[model samples]
Structures are given as C-alpha cells and as structure tokens.
Target: MTERQQHKRRRGAGVAAGVLCVCLAGSGCAQSGAAAEDAREGEAVQAVRSAADALVGARSSKARTSMEMATGGTRVTIRGEGVYDFRRQIGQLKVQLPQDPAGTPDQRPIMELLAPGALFMKNRGAGVPADKWVRVETRSLSDGNLVTGGATDPFAAAEVLRGARTATYVGEDEIAGTPVRHYRGTADLGIAAQDASDGNKESLAAAAKGFATDKVPFDVYLDEAGRIRKVRHRFSFVNGQMNNAVAVASTTLLYDFGAPVDVRLPDGDDIYAGKIAEE
Candidate 1:
C-alpha cells in the first residue's frame, strides 16, 4: 500500500486500539469471571454517561479526553489532545495510537514518525468531497468522534446523548497493564447534524456516500467505572464488495473533568488545495 494509505490504516487502527483500552472492561473467563465483569460494568457505563454530560458543560481552549469500552468480543480505546484555535475558528484534535493491543491506551502515538501536514492536504480540500464519495486520506485526529468538530458531531453528541440504556458493571480485570471494570450494552446514538451545510461538501459527500448504500450499525461498550470502553462500528463504503468493510472501533479514557476542547476550522487553502488535487 502507498504511504498515505498506510498512514490512514495506521491511524484508524490506532483509534480503534486506543478506544479498546478504555472502553472494554474485560470479562471473567469462567462463571466467576462473568460475575466480576457484570459487577463493575454498570458503574463504568454510568461514569461515561456523566462524563458525556460534563463535556457538554465545558468550554476550554484546549484539553485532553479519553474513553474506554467493550463490544461483542472486541475492546476499543481512544485518546485525544484537543487544541482550540480561536483565530482559526476550529479545534486541532491530536489522537495517539495504541502502544499495546491487549488494552493499553495510546498515551503517545507515533504519528509524527509516519508523516505530518494536513493528512489529506492534497484531497478535494480541507474537507471531504461534496459528491458523496469515499476518499480516504491520512488526516489528523478527530476532534471527538466520527464527525468533525461541532456540537452535533460525535464529540458534541456524546455530551448530550440521551436515551442511553442502563449499563451492568462487570468486575475488574487487567488489560495492557491497567486494571478496569467492564460494562456491556448497545448505545443507540441517533446523531443528526444541526447544520449539514458547513461548506465541507466533499467531506460530507465522501462520508455520506457510504452508509446509505450499505448497512451499518453502531455498537458500544463501557468500563467498570462507567467510562466508554469499546465501540464497534460497521458501515457501508463506496467500495462495498471489493474493499473490506469500513468499521471504526474505539475506546476512551482519562476524561478532563470540566475542561473545554477547541477545534480549529480548516483554512481556505487546505480545502482549495484538496479540491485542486481532485480536479
């Protein structure tokens, strides 16, 4: 694969791996293990629910947030360092990669070692194409979740995501050197963007072109402390049959009590350059 493709794969893997760390609180193997996993999972789910609320109340220029969770047979973790650039009118979300697959959070991602600059600086611009196509590039970390920086997007959505099912806490378990409680359940995240006309046509198109044409669903998990443990995401992409399924699995941890996260808006040149490349 090309270096760019490799980077995208690596970053995607990192996010999934990082999320796995905090999201999935492992279950006990035998009957005893199952009981242990159940005990703490409920608490973990509650913690995440509360943290999501706290994020909604925060307004910081910069901060760090992490979450952990578990889904069907999978553990995910995600870590992020957010930078708010007022001049730019956006937030710079820097996510680290997972160091250990067994459930270690990405305290540090070797992203720099891969390459820098606007990951898809050469794409149809700073955002996806407006035509609803699948354009994969080595972009920077996400401000929070699937969508970019905004209230209705993944990061902001988490803060006000109601309709969450009660979680059952499982007991503590050790993963990648960390001890955690486990929680299990599916989170029905009905996210609707308030403003779908943010001007990032390419980006939106690219993202939208996939799911509808294919079938995808959202799966979630939590840790013993009620923190998000894992998220198993399966979606349809433009290259449905030929390409592997487009899935995002993540975990979160180390939430910043009430810190605000700033997301930087892409500049004119970033988008223009990407458009030019596409042209």
Candidate 2:
C-alpha cells in the first residue's frame, strides 16, 4: 500500500477505536464479570431489541464514523466526526479525504451537512470555488445505496439490528475499558435499507445493488442499561458497473441521550446555488 493508503487505514482504525470510547463514555457501562455469563439467549436478544428502540428514539448524539471501500478499481476511505440531531433531522460532519494523486496541490478536506431533504458538500479543488457549498438533493439517496447515501443517519445502526434475521449473543467485550455485551447478526439488507429509506427508490440500479447479497453481517454492543454502545458492519456489492465494491463501517455513539446538538445552515453567501449530479 502507498503512504496515503496506509494513512487512511490508520485513521480508519483510529475512528473505530474512538467510536468505542464514545459508546463506553456515553452509555456509562459498569464492570460486571458475571453479567456476561449470566446472559440468556432470549433475554439477550430482547435486550438488544430494547437498546435498538432506545437508539432509534434518541434525540441527539456525537458520533465518529469510518468507511473504506473500493469502487470501480478506485479505493476510497473516509473518516468523519459529527453530531446528529434526530429532532431536527440534520447533522454536520467534518470529513477527511485522501490526497488526490492527479490533482493540483492545496486541496482541502471536505465538510458535509446532511438533512432529510438535502445534503451540502464543501470541498476545495480545481473548478470548485473555495467559498461555495454544493447542494445535493437527497431523494436519490433513498435508493438504499450506502455509497450514494443513507449512512449519515446515526440511527442507521439500530435499524440494521432491527432488521436482523438472526441475532446471536457473542459474549462480552471491553470497549474503551467499559464492559459491553456483544451481539452479531445476519441482517437482510433489503429490509434494513428499506426501513432506513422508507422504501423510497429513485434509482433502480442503486436499489438493486445491495441485493447481490440477500444478507449482510452486523455487530452491536450494548451497555448494562440495554442501550446501544457501538455498531460495526461490512458491506459488499457487485452489480451493474460497480464491480466488486466493498465497504466497512464502525460507528460509536457519544454522550448521554438528549444532549443538545446544533447544526446550523451555511450562510447564504457561502451556499452554492447549483445542484450536484447524482452520486
């Protein structure tokens, strides 16, 4: 791997670890050695379901996210820090991008603001102005394509767990020094994404991409209070012209529930009036 690739990999791993810390600190898991062995199959699954409910019902949270994927022979890795507010249905992310080997020097990292109706992206590169933020309509994002969109929502992890066909307790593990119960599942992607998207599909190709595999694996960790602490998953797809693209995501929830999160819109002078082409 090149230095840039190695750097991205390290950052991705760091984000993963950071997410664990967020989960542990947010949920405030206490150390209890017997809780792991005392867990019952049915009870553990129910606890996970309850945690999923709480996560979906949460108002706002701080999150760290990482995704590494290959699409059409180009590998892309993204690491992000952000806060999501379900009450406002909006979030803002500071994203780190790999340097472009084929571009001029001085390209800055990107910033993204996501809302239910729109996504705003700001990047400094050739042909793109430094002061403008590109506006993207999110209707196409409802096509269940993680690449195109859908991962921005903090509740996406809980939705994945709710759609699991089989959820198995995987014992306990320490995340950021806090004890948590681990659960693994094979989730039906169609159902999971559809649930997240409300079954809206603007692009048939994008909607069908995840169906290449009827199911995908997901893991979740829960604190003793039955609240979700962290989630991790790997996703792969091969269809149309995408080749065999694969993505892995690790997300950690931070702070207590109902913590205030403010995601303000960009100033009018800084907002670009033009629309972005579909991803």
Candidate that scores best on TM-score: 2
Off by over 4 Å in 2: 1-45, 56-58, 71-76, 100-107, 124-126, 142-145, 149-152, 193-211, 239-242, 245-247, 250-258, 266-279
Candidate 2's residue-wise lDDT over 1-279, tens digit each? 699999999999999999999888766544343455345555655665566456546767777766666645777666777887755657777777655557657345677786655667788344557778876655454334344442434555555555566677888897667788898877765555454534222222243344446466777888776667787766655545545445545454544567677778887788766544443
Of candidate 1, the 10-residue stretch with the lowest lDDT total is 110-119
Give Cα-based local distance difference scores for all models: 0.37, 0.62
Put down candidate 1 lDDT per residue, 50-97, tens digits, no spaces: 544333344323434343434344555556554432222234445554
TM-score of each: 0.38, 0.66
